[model samples]
Target: MSDTPLLDQLESGPWPSFVKDLKRVAARKPAAKDLLKQLDRSYKDKITHWKHGGIVGVLGYGSGIIGRYSDLPDEFPGVEHFHTIRVNQPSGWFYTTQALRDLCDIWDRHGSSILNVHGSTGDMIFLGTTTDELEPTFAELTAKGWDLGGSGSAMRTPSCCVGKARCEYSCYDTMDFCYEMTQEFQFDMHRPSFPYKFKIKCSGCPNDCVAAVARADLSVIGVWKDDIRIDQAAVAAYHAGEIKPRGGGSPYAKLDVKADVTDLCPTACMSFDGKKLAIDNKNCNHCMHCISLMPQALRVGTDTGATLLLGSHAPILEGAQMSWVIVPFTEMEPPYDNIKELIANIHEWWSENGKNRERVGELMLRLGMRNFFKSVGLEPPSQTVRTPRANPFFFWHAEDFEAEAAGRKYIKI
Candidate 1:
């Protein structure tokens, strides 16, 4: 009989199955075998039998190693304390062969040997390990120059896309910035002292491969504020179909220079007269549509920088929100003092006003952005909102209106 009859059903499908991998792990790790049994019971019962215990880690850190112990420990003794071990991955998830080998070797020695490529928040996740094994496992990884990611109410591990390493469109060195950010905020990452978790993600350009705008609390995306540099000859090549649109990835049957490039522009600022191309640079929104289609012809402005957006989060307290512009554009020079100051100010404000378990975004929502902007010393721009709220909401206190007008005709409430 199959150990996991229900789980084996998943294997029959065309896609590869984790159940198959679990069975493989079960062969060597007793914990995995029992885990399968517990899962079978879970399928039959339709209820969770796992409970969060006093999980701990090696680095004298109290968080990051997340686990839920089996409630039916007597029945599934081998899988009693399967904790998740989160390793702080390198920027862009780039790892050499030796590094991967080392991690696999450590997992084989002390863990269930099941691992995730990376988690949504950007940590390289080891799926199964005992609480006692965490210390030894992390010790070996650290010796090989790796560390733990964040969890609980602290800042989560920061991440960045592969910028200069491979991407030609990179406006800044995203990996370096992300690395420095990780280092600068080490204390926050290790210590669980925030009202809620915080995430920071960087993208080399507005391509946003890291989904920074939608996923990060603090989204740093590369941008250019000046004119789009245009090369006439390259533009002619693209217009003539001599150069394929994004190397032949367009949905259009034939590359229609007008339909694909000029007309589709959000600002409608591009014009091509067959052999000649013209762009109204001042009207350009830097949407990257044209630049992406004709990379050789249209290049990002020389005055490259990054845009700062804040308060974006997944649906939990508030609905899923994309980041809004905080700073429209700023040169992200090394020793990034501009960003450092803003972050310090934000943290200081949030630490004082944020409620227990409330996200910084929720805090801003509660207090209202006007007051929040005043407290943080930020100039709220039109770019802050896609469109001005038709119905504006505010939180006015007793002192917001004059004491003399309390009973008068002027109604502040």
Candidate 2:
């Protein structure tokens, strides 16, 4: 019963999130006004629950559909007013001042000024609007050549790490693939028919600059069949104290002679020459660090592309895991039809067999990767999938139904 407002009660703590946003919108948005009023009344009345206006959705778009909430029974305050839209971001994020201004002008016309630069999964999140405005907004966007992306239960937006355009470590073109997949998988992004969420990410190297290991369902990584690049001049620069390693997240803890980066070189491409270095293309791992560290002296070869790794979902499906090269490397040349075809194969497989709330990783685990491979009609590649458990459960094609003991024997071990 104190004089302090209910908003103050909710906003007093460290994660005073709603309060922070409300403060910014209070003067302009009537919806913010209603939100504060509802919170205050709920606090004073000690009410803890509210109901939603019956399920509402966008006409053509699916998933990213959100529910509407209300405090008053049978009354949806500004039912005509709530809207959410997603804006795609440019790869590498280099925005011109004019581009920024143009984007703002569009938002001011169709949405509230408040904008979340990027959503938790990394797409521009815009909030606030009316139901009546959706089609109009979408029409305007399409006419301006802008399009919507996935949200809600559909496939989320695809993301990529800085690649060939900026980073020296890039063995493949990440931006090209990201944009290509964005256009090719329009159905997945626009519709909602997945067991759970699907995410795609591309990285310039094994370093996983985009955190695809933790977030994405399918991860595409740049790799090469060749060896690592070594520049004696660059290694000398490091020794001479002229070059400094900046990114703290080096895969190798500390580059010392013992690290044997040269010996461990996948392509045996790197060798130290009397404190100098040399790169033999025949054996480079395409790990990119040595080249990234010495851009002037080292670089990836042309003919480089990416490997499509699959079934890397969040811990829910399996413990935190990285994707495995299910399809090995493919040509990432412009007009990425190969990548698109692969995506179609995966979606068809999932839609036919997956159950609700079951992620692709979980589906693979239950059906056995061998069955998944056979069903997808793709030839299995060596080292395609890695299992932490050395001896996992499996069923053999030769086993007979009468041999119950044999089936149970593998389980006993």
Candidate No. with top TM-score: 1
All candidates: TM-score: 0.90, 0.76
Model 2: residues with Cα > 4 Å off, grouped in runs: 1-22, 33-55, 63-65, 68-81, 91-94, 247-274, 277-303, 315-319, 392-395, 399-413
Q: Please, what are the lDDT tens digits per residue for candidate 1 over residues 238-277?
A: 7667777775676643467787889999999888777777
Scored by lDDT, the top model is 1
lDDT of each structure?
A: 0.83, 0.67
lDDT of 2: 0.67
lDDT of 2 by residue, 281-397 (tens): 655545665655545555566556777787776564346666666877777787887677777778788878998877777787788777678777677776574754576764554
Model 1, position 412: C-alpha lDDT score: 27
Worst 10 residues of 1 by lDDT: 404-413
